[model samples]
Target: MTETQIWALVFVALTFSVYIYIAWRSRVRETRGFFVAEQNVPAIANGAAVAADWMSAASFISMAGLIAFLGSDGSVYLMGWTGGYVLLALLLAPYLRKWGKFTVPEFVGDRFSETVRSVAAVVAIIVSFTYVVGQMAGGGIVFSRFLEIPQAGGVAIAAAVIFTYAVFGGMKGITWTQVAQYTVMIVAYLIPAWAVAHTITGIPVPQVSFGRILEELNALQAEFGLDQYTQAFTARPQLDVFLVTMALMIGTAGLPHVIIRFYTTKSVRGSRWSALWALVFIALLYTTAPAVGAFTKFNLLQGVQGQPVDALPQWVQNWQATGLVSVSESADTITSITNKATVFADGGADLLVNNDILVLASPEIAGLPAPIVGLVAAGGLAAAMSTAAGLLLVISSSVSHDLYFRYVDHHASEARRLGVSRIAMGLAVLVAIYFGINPPAFVAQVVAFAFGLAASTFFPLLVLGVFWKRTNAAGAVSGMLAGLAFTGSYMIHTLEVFGTSAHEYVFGISPEGIGTLGAVVNLVVTIVVSLATRPPSHEVQEMVEQIRYPAEREEVGAN
Candidate 1:
């Protein structure tokens, strides 16, 4: 194997060893321990776990590339994701903790009805599974590049690692493992970013250096006859950008895996504080992303602009061989060294560059040392694997805890429940691996679908369930179904799943941005349906009131 490949394997092995040790140490015997860490995790540790879980491969690998190419328009991801944590802290986390549920569907089931619970469980599975596919695809990319394996092989390796800890140790094991992963991923992300920032502007702090980098980038883009990176809106329309950002922000609060993190905290206060800490950790990366994107773009333009394809740098050649970067000649002359348009843009350009390769290739593009390159690989793996594990747990819990244990055999023993959870987790991992092997689109694109779905189906229900005591089970169920149907149909139509273009999108919103509309649809449907139906029973309203007041609750133990 090459030196880079060997270093990657060594880092992967060392990280996996640490995760295994933590999982083994935190092994649980009861269903409560397996599902929610016995609600004993400290606030800070839970915060780090939430950070690791929230920032998936999309944030680590693709966000910078999107910012690099889309320029100011890419701030949608930055603002949407980080801003969502604020929504979580203010609107969701503490109240959910006070309710003290193992899974999101359990809360829905209690507040609404068993029927609504079943619907919520199905929504959770769909959202979690869609999200897991993206994480696995991200892991596959890291493995394919660093470990010199096929994408399928990389996905299988990730599946095995996640299955080992997630299936065996459950949430208790996964929580501690996530804390370690948060450390690895953040360090991995910051090191190369700092290196690149220092190289470009003599600044060590990437977030602080971003302004200086943007100034330089503006001058460079003008010189190259391209659009300015500092422009407020470049590739996408401003309204669409705003809508997409809103969807992402609301979607963050709606994501099932992220919501479940609060369930592991020791108390309602811990859950609230945990959201703050989670954002602090997440911001460490999110704030640096634009800097990474800007600097990487500046570096690439300096190296490849006006340079002949035959005389391109060794890194370009290596990337070209991976099929992420391609060169085409027209009349024996190379026109463009890299295409900056979206990957899904119609009519493929001559020099097609995959945005996903931006971060992975940034170290080499900056001419960094081999060790740093290897570290980037490890960081990407940590990001992808951490998210995959969290998503798998969400899917497993929905199936085993919500559907199987709750509905199949409510009288089953704890041991039986734990066994069913492990089996469900294993099956979920297999399904995710299969989808990873044959991904529907780019990693970030698939993840956007997950966010949109979550925003549409869950965000409205959760927000109104807590804030509006009049929201009945019928309204919640109808609203969820309407949102899912509209969003799914819109996606199918826009994505051209039926081999014909419907092109009936509202206000020119892309599939990624449609979640906001879906959320709106859900809200309207909920209000209309609730007005037509009877209000929630007094007991349900009392439960909502209890969750609202943290001081009125007693700590309930597992049955």
Candidate 2:
């Protein structure tokens, strides 16, 4: 590590300190406080917290890296994440908050039926665990890269820290801590992206510079005999893929962890304001990633040409020491491993160049010193931790609200419920740590899976449930199950069961984006099933109306 790297570490450490301090100071005592920060959070603060928690490692580390490698094709994530927020502001947040529940499972149960609520609880746990594992893995990647530790060791350290804050403090603690984490992650993501952009095209605003880079990228592709790659996608009508994107856009509004954030707001208006705040905060990083990606790609093509395959710049060397970057050793090995030849150290560098490292490798490609690289590591960690904490809250509440209060002990005191929540939180952290050590998948890839699942399973039901008066419990359950089953089975057969070398793709659409089909099947099944079943009861229809309007309705009307 260089002199600059030491200072970057200091800044990152200071950021962590601030998160701990703020979270500790904000610890809440009541069950409501633990669940929703006692509903006392200001709109701006809650928004920041939501944004920080929502933008995970994939947003910080993986998306840029994906963009760096995929060029214009990478805008999927930019669109997916941002589109989710728009859906939130336009459709989900206001109604969800007006429903006035601390946990999404609780709302689902109340809205549809106890059975539907029970099913939603299962889905929430799966979604949160799957998503949070990615966050924890991302944290491990940051730790490995910056702290010069083994991947498992790094994951352990991060898990320990996440556990300390999430278990002890609850939502009140996690909420304020997320606000601090938001500042760290956004600054870390933007500053380096800005520096890289200025160096590449002399532009201070990364969004503009990124556009310029894309122009040059188009030219570069023409030079590299890759004009077809650039032009091929245009002519390629990915109908199924288009469907997946639709599902994702619909799904974003319904994610349980994301939905729960609205409950922290003191009022319906505050929820609206928080959504806007999240959008603003998210925009800072999203706007910059395209630039960072193009610049990194350009620099990589320049830096790594024809050298000894293992030769990397100082920062690259440092990252290798840290382990954020992975490689397969031979072209044949990559061919054998297919596109995912991402495992490092055991003869993979010559075999494959992981696209995941593109952002982490940016400084090295540009010959920037280690300190900037270190800062990137810190940024990645902030993103992971912030999102992980938010997910943990959701997971904890799944047990506390859905199972404990609903079935285990309907009369359990609030304090007893809180204690159960802490236990659940601790268990969630343990599960996250387990996945982090033995990573099940790529950071961005895993997140995409979660999104697709959300799109197919959660989004359709929530949207229909909220807006379509005819959508009933039978439809919701059938839709969610069909979406989940179709997506999972199709992806496994198409992506994993069939090898990439054999060209195992379903109509050339990736598993990462294919759930769009599942979503459609879900909607169709839901419609069919609802038609087959009776309309929801009067009380359920009335519940829908309560969430739709802003004016205060009678308490009798609310239930």
Cα TM-score per model: 0.95, 0.90
Model 1 ranges with Cα > 4 A deviation: 223-225, 331-350, 498-505, 553-559
Q: For model 1, give the 10-residue run with minimal summed lDDT.
A: 329-338
In terms of lDDT, the poorest run of 10 residues in model 2 is 331-340
Q: Report the lDDT tens digits of candidate 1 across residue range 1-559.
A: 8777788888888898998888889888998988898999999999999999988999999989888888888899999999999899999999999999789999999999999999999999989988999999999988888887998999998889888889888998899999999999988889899999999889899888878867778877776566789797677677888889999999999999999999999999999999989999999999989989998888887787666667877777867666777766441333343454552244343456678988989988999888788888878888998888988898999999889876679898888989989999999999999999998778898898898999999999999999999999999999999999998888888885537675766777888888999999999999999989999999999999999888844558734
Per-residue C-alpha lDDT of model 2 across residues 1-559, encoded as one tens digit per residue: 6465585678777877777777678766678988888888899999899888888988887887766555555556677678878888888888888887788878777778888888888889888887988888888776665566678988887777777788778988888888888887877777777788888889878888766766666665454434422432442245643654565666567688888999989988899999999889888888888778778766765554344545644544554554444444453221111124433345433423455566666766676666777677777788898899888898899888787788878898877888888999998888888888887777776777777777788777777888987888888888889999998776676654334322366676767666677778888999999988999999899989888887676698676
Q: Give the whole-model CA lDDT for all candidates, comma-separated.
A: 0.87, 0.75
Q: After superposition, how far is residue 119 of candidate 2 from its true place, in Å?
A: 0.6
